[model samples]
Target: MAASMSVTFLDVGQGDATLVSADGHHVLIDGGQARDDAIVPLRRKGIQQLDLVVATHAHADHIGGLISVLEDKPVDTLWYNGDEHTTQTFEAFLDAALDSAARYVEPTRGRTKALGGLEVTALHPGGDTQGGHLHDRNIVVRVSQGACSAVITGDIETDGEHDILRSSIEVDADVLELGHHGSRTSTGQRWLEAVDPDYVVAQYSEGNHYGHPHGEVLERVERAGAEMLGTGAHGTIRMRCSGGEWQARTEAQGPVVAGDREAEAAPGAPAEEPPATEAEVGCIDLNEASPEALEQIVHIGSVRAEAIIDGRPWSSVSELDVIHGLGPARVGDIEEQGEACVR
Candidate 1:
């Protein structure tokens, strides 16, 4: 019999969590908030030991419930983006991970891990990448089994999306979990075009405070002509692939046609404001950003971050060449990344 892979998107309220299993191997990505039930699916499926567990980033909504998973389950390995948060939830998660016997790994772009019939590839957070807003530093991974693939994005916004593309990662997939819970800040037209998924899943609460699955994002998904599924509307989502064919089924219903889930706006209410794209947002302003924020840009670490801060009010991205350790070649890399700006 041919191998089969199953990807389950848990209904973790306004957060992200996914379970992928194939040939007796299981990988859980981004457990939801502390209040959510991220463990129910594991128990329901009789999965006792996880081969791999990934915390895409350190946000409470993304890694909060993972604390319990590490504490209770037998996880062989744990991969995090190395982004840290000061929240109690993050501290607890770190503690649990330290206490567990799982081998810890900080995945960077281009790293791939294989277990059983599945291949997991990290697509974001480049090797020199560090210290930015949590969303920009999100760890995006693409899970593949045979010919089928799914890209799992954890609250990654537009800049992060562009970084993945700029890094030349292959993102085309059969399934895509929408970024930032389908907010306008993510799922840009270019990103949608790059991934070109057959099915897209949005993981957010029905009446979330953030009003996820924004009208613009819905329109983009509709325009791309991909089937749309939501944990809020569909409960839990599961997709299976075997013999190179992929199919999606949700807890409430099967796959939904793209145009069916349009966002409703109040009469005369203005549309949700769109977020700045890579071009529009320009880049991390060298003069304004603190050392920590400057460190988020590729090729710039704590030392360079401080140097740039000390040389305040720079004129252009080209001026970065003057900073110590950043030669013409490194400056070109920063320009190619499109992540740093002077103004």
Candidate 2:
């Protein structure tokens, strides 16, 4: 059987779309901004049904591909943070939600649902505050299966971050979908401290204007010791949850067996030693493995181990801070090292 539940993050240049399957259920977080382009990737990844469709906000990059996603697969439950602005893309999302006969869910601070055995909970969308407020309000969804969990934060910014921090919500997550494509204004240090995810995933188009994942944001993400995964680089990120051992699959990676990590240790095994499985390098599941399991990589040490265990499923590998020990290391070195073994 597959090792675990799966989260497939499509590389749709500058757009956001993640296909997730866990415990025999499928849930799509969002489609790329280009609905047509997004559907092709969905088909490529073998996505057929969308048990839940979440439009984090009314941004084009977040929901432009909704029509295409629904066209390919029926969306069972549609959720979006109600917007105060009336952008064309927002209207399109509402239309698709209505036409598809989906149950529109305005997620609150603590609503939960069961997708197979996986648990999905809402953590953001405290609603637009009274008086003047920055409009980055978003519907952040947290999906968990056993010990693994990932928090998907839609185009939220620092102001929105404040609201989420103030709420009586569980901000602690294994992985955090970096807000606003890793904008400097979104990942506040305090907020980062609260989540301290093992991975930080970013959704952005290649060569797009407004240079997403700004340098400062990138530095902050790295400083936090979380890893970064990108649609720009990782191709498509897919994960599987097998009880507590979350196995990940991606267009850029291969396969792995648990025992392969241990018993084969050559003590001083060269950091450049070959991987036991065809699994992608630098990528690890937070739900599985141990401190020693973490040290298998070249530069990884005790501190990095703490970060991995401290944070569960990471949004991406870039935020994992491998550079802390390895330094601008090549992808092959840490690519499949089990970023966060979250189940």
| Model 2 C-alpha lDDT per residue in residues 214-293, reported as the tens digit of each score | 77887787788665666554455555444455444434434323334321221112223333332343245544555544
Off by over 4 Å in 2: 1-3, 127-135, 243-343
Which window of 10 residues has the lowest lDDT sum in candidate 1?
262-271
Root-mean-square deviation of every model? 22.2, 13.8
Structural similarity to truth (TM-score) of each candidate: 0.74, 0.69
Best by lDDT: 1
- Candidate 1, residue 4: Cα displacement in angstroms equals 1.2
Q: Write the per-residue lDDT of candidate 1 for residues 1-343, one digit (tens) a residue.
A: 4566778888898899999877557899999996446775565444578999999988888998898889889999999977778989999999999999999999889889998668999998888665569887788999998887999999888888888889887989988999999999999999999999988889888878788889889888878988777887766676777766665555454443334544322212332444234422324578875553465456776688778978887989889899988899978877766657765
Indicate the residue-level lDDT of 315 in model 2. Answer: 61
What are the lDDT figures for the candidates, one per model?
0.79, 0.64
